[model samples]
Target: MIAAPLREKKRYGWFDAALRALLEETDAALEAGVDVPEEPGGWWHQYVCPTHGTELRFDPREREATAFRCPHGCVLEGEAYRGAWLVFKHQERARTALSAAAMYAATGEAKYAEAANAILEAYASRYPRYPVHPDAQPWMLKGRAFHQALTEAIWATTILRAFLLLRDEGALQVDAAASDVFFAMVSSSMTEYRRILIEERDEPANNYTAWLNACLACYYAVRDDRDGMETLVSARGGLRHHLEIGVLPDQLEFEGSLYYHVFVLRAYFIAAEMAERLGFDATAWTGSAGQSFRGMLEALVGLAAPNGELPALHDGPYSRPPYAREIAEVFEIGYARYGDARFAPILREAYRRADGGCGGGTGSAERRGLEAVLYGEGDWPAAEPLREPSRLYASAGFAVLRHADNPLSLLADFGPHGGSHGHDDKLNVVLMHRNGFVLPERGMVPYGSELRRRWFARTPSHNAVSVGGRTQAPHTGVCLRFDAEARRSYAWLRSEGAYAGATLDRHLWVDRDVALDWFEVRLDLEETVDYWLHFAEPLNVGGGWTACTPDAAPGEDEAYGYVATSARWTAEEPFAAVAATCGGERVTASLLAVPGGELYRIASPGTSVDPSRPLDGLLYRARGRRATFVAAFAAGDAPIRLARGDEGSVLVAPAGGGGTAMRFRMTEHGLHRE
Candidate 1:
């Protein structure tokens, strides 16, 4: 069993051809290369910003490498971008170590082996002296290997993988003392990494937590530490213990961020690959939803937009996040083990559609040179996922409704307003029409931008109800019912803790006609309740809710709320209803007022008078004990109409009325019609 890694390598000998090709491409000509990289010990060597003509240098000999400054005036404005640079620095070293190992295997070049050994030695000697980051969360973690244990884990996983390669292949030639020192450096730092994982054991496995576990599993396997490797098994109650519990039953990560989903899934695949090499048994694990390996991949397929990009739910990319790219190449290892035809084709197609032409962009920590070498050659068979859409993560309280023909997906959020990465979008509704948004979540913004607070975390961006004009409280969302049928299906979600005494329930029925999309939202408030309908850029607006439209800028500066002298819907003025057309779809929204008429407050089409402002959603509001809004939206040239029954049921009719209509029966308990 100890020789399992050798057997595994021998099994994949076809990959050696690819590795040799990459070696020649890089000219791994040991005949002429001798000088080590000038700066070899610390993070990055030196970087110059092309935009500002500024430079930031790192000296491996200096203890205060983090205290360096920007010369020629290129001060980075945000730390997220800065953090990416730091990760990149580690990535460069990892790529180097991997390249050297692969090159040595292909060419039997002594220089390649020596170069890889020198870098590892440098890391081993300097690894212990690095101080723990002061601002790391959880308070107990102290990263002596790097500024944060997360970064330290990345560094360890990288060099250690190379170490295993060299040691197993007989490329490593070192004295006994040198070997002992290298082993000691790794043992000490890895202990700190393990401590962080043990401390945060009970929390859900977010990206970093999952990463730490997977990396350590690989570490123990490489070191041949039997007791340590056992710590990762489910029987021992370890981090990788139970896949069923950590990943929600729907197979989506709890955070709901596509990038994080990719981050964590990548960690699992990498670890599983390493475990296989070292003769570990983790490759066969499966979760309740499906297996975390294949099941989660299908879940991601369901959550994706028609174009294959996922919505940036939490701390995901501002534009559609690219975590799916992480799946294709990393999934190669999993496909070999499962041989599930369903997974390979879906993964390959997604990889084919990648904007980068593969999984990662150049110069990203996600891109490993060896990954390119190990990926399959041109003989991949074409395949597609054997699954359909609108998967529900019941345990996490979320659901998505999708139709392959319509390319329109409705994502309903009722899950944990997850952690810090989560937005305050419990029971929020996001409608996806191909690449366009009917109602969108506050997409991410640069962390340091003004829009970050104004758009990312606030209530106005989400399609939610504000009771008494206050945002909902921090409550996990609940999905009461979800049925995905051709035309008769509907979605229902409830938010009990969004307010102190108020409860908001939303139900949406998707008519197969694509022109009779109807919904009814009920807000039970103790004091005042204002139901909001935030639409994307509207093509046309015809309604009674336009009276609150501001004529100028300061009037719509978010501070001033317009008070109409005479209300239109409830008014002394006249009675009218709200209607709109967006991206060729017509939407009509109306509230089920008990006996009185509906009162509303709507922003002007150019409310801010600045067409540049992203705040274009309309707000139709009312103050009462209980208010229910019945609305319908559809895609086509016809206007959708609604009629309410005396018994409190509502009927929605689309143009061309070809026996395709939807109804909603309002009741004291809840909705009875669909």
Candidate 2:
């Protein structure tokens, strides 16, 4: 039998060792005397660029000291040099380096040209010496450190693009002195990235870090680094091994988090892209590169709410990126390559939803879908145009959009249970309508370490089952270990048309049932735990007063209980049971109900909200073993059973057998076979 590949034996020493040495030498030089001269009028800096930390010595005295060298020796002029390196200081720094270099070439000013050259030279000089940071040691476990890593990666990509721009535009008019350094920098950077992949492959603790490393490797591979490409592929294989070993594929059971799913898609997307670039023939992979691309895109599209946002869980310090922008690019690229445009609209909607790019309007689901297709319903072109909002975070949502044509709705969960950016939303499914959304994910926002840990990462922020009487594990105060079972979600279009909708079934455990409605939902979580479903939107009650139990306390971890209020009070039915409970140890199951004036009071939140939305319903909590509550709704004379359960208490509303509306709440012991 063949033995597993050994890490030490892998080959990259020839180039990697040299790169590390050069980078160290450059770092010392920059620390020693490399300084950006203080200009009188404009901003010149002796400070380091917080992101990549390239040294800068900018001098305004252009005539005598026509050039200022970074440690790597690429020279730069006064203002342009400042713009080239410091992105946080100015927006122009975000532009491609090639563009910045062009500005200098056009002016024929030695200082400006040198400023650009300095950036390239600095990188080049250390290129052969820069070692991979990941291989040095373990990264800090704190969320802030991980966050910093994320930022650095983003900044580095932009800098790389600038270099590409310079090279593409023929703006590197300097002698080999500068050119050699620039090439070395590129090579060194690639080698460092290779090291990251190697480490991730050897030991991947965090899926996000793994994916980020894979993305770096893909970038290098596309730049024609064969070693880098293979390393990433090998890392991917290692990740898969861990998953297969630690996780159950058939039924994904996550404690509560969506971070892993997001990163998994990211790794796949980058790997697929890089593979295609290397002429590996993406078709060999399951469903082809186009399929993989479309699968991820559609996944993002389907994950989005009607309002084009995701849920409150798993959201943190990282700003949400534009989903549509990425879908558009990937879909267009795949379409051009494979001649398939079926999922093109998936990309379009992602853009439209994320960036308001559909052109027609906002909040119109139909229009968004139509706009996406209409825009891309054109003939194939050699190369499509690229637009703004290309950030990776923004593109994260495109995973769903890319998977538009996939037969199954994918669901995954894995990641840390606590700490920053943790969302107690494990085993969640990115559901799909026959065509669009069902219970769309609420988009994330900037991370607030304190707030996130306190509330955002809690149980009520996701779609899952609550155990005992709480959303989290009683012992650990985190989520419990519950596996997903018999996962399946796929639908076909019917004559009812685009708005008719489709059915999705993401079964958990053995035979749990989860059903959805236009404005309300009914889930018989027999095999699961006490159900706790969260709505990103607030509930609107039209009648009685609102109320709840074990409600919000000062600074306590939000426990389970009932919190509800009346929507309307018309003399006949005045008091509203905001939320109520019946059976269990003190309070186990809790029910939260809302009335829509229609028959389905316990239905899922509707896709269409009034142009002017109303305040959402009160949150319900339970701490015991069982609970129940009944909400009333005017169903236009229809006697509808919103929901019913056997083990726990069931809320029941009777509108006088057809009296327009009815009322309900928990029964005696919590049995509601009625």
Return the top candidate by lDDT: 1
**Per-candidate local distance difference test:** 0.53, 0.32
Cα shift from native, residue 377, model 2 (Å): 9.5
Q: Backbone clash tally for model 1?
A: 4
In Å, residue 420's CA in model 2 sits off its true spot by 7.3
How well does candidate 1 match the true structure in TM-score terms?
Answer: 0.71
Residue 25 of model 1, lDDT score: 33
User: What is candidate 2's CA lDDT for residue 563?
Assistant: 21
Summarize candidate 2's per-residue lDDT along 619-662 as a digit string, tens digits: 33322222322322221222223444344333343323433221
On residues 1-674, what C-alpha lDDT tens digit does candidate 1 reach at each position? 11223223434544555455446533443322322222222222123333322234332222223343443445553343344345444555555665677667656777778877766766655544544555444543445444456656655676777787788778775444655565565556655555545454644353566666666766776667767666565433344553655577777776777656766777777666566665667646777456567777767666655434455566654331133345555555545555555455445434443334321232222212344344432233443333355677786566777655553457777888767777767777776665345665545543333444444455545666666655556678677777877655567777778777666777765544442223333444445554455655543444433253343212222312322212234433222334445445554443334344245444421111121333445454555677766555555545455666556666666545556545667564445556
Query: Which portions of model 2 show Cα errors greater than 4 Å?
Result: 1-150, 161-202, 205-279, 282-295, 298-342, 353-422, 426-443, 463-471, 474-538, 546-615, 621-624, 628-674
Worst 10 residues of 1 by lDDT: 604-613
Angstrom error at residue 421, model 2:
5.5
Candidate 1 colliding pairs: 234-241, 390-400, 414-477, 473-498
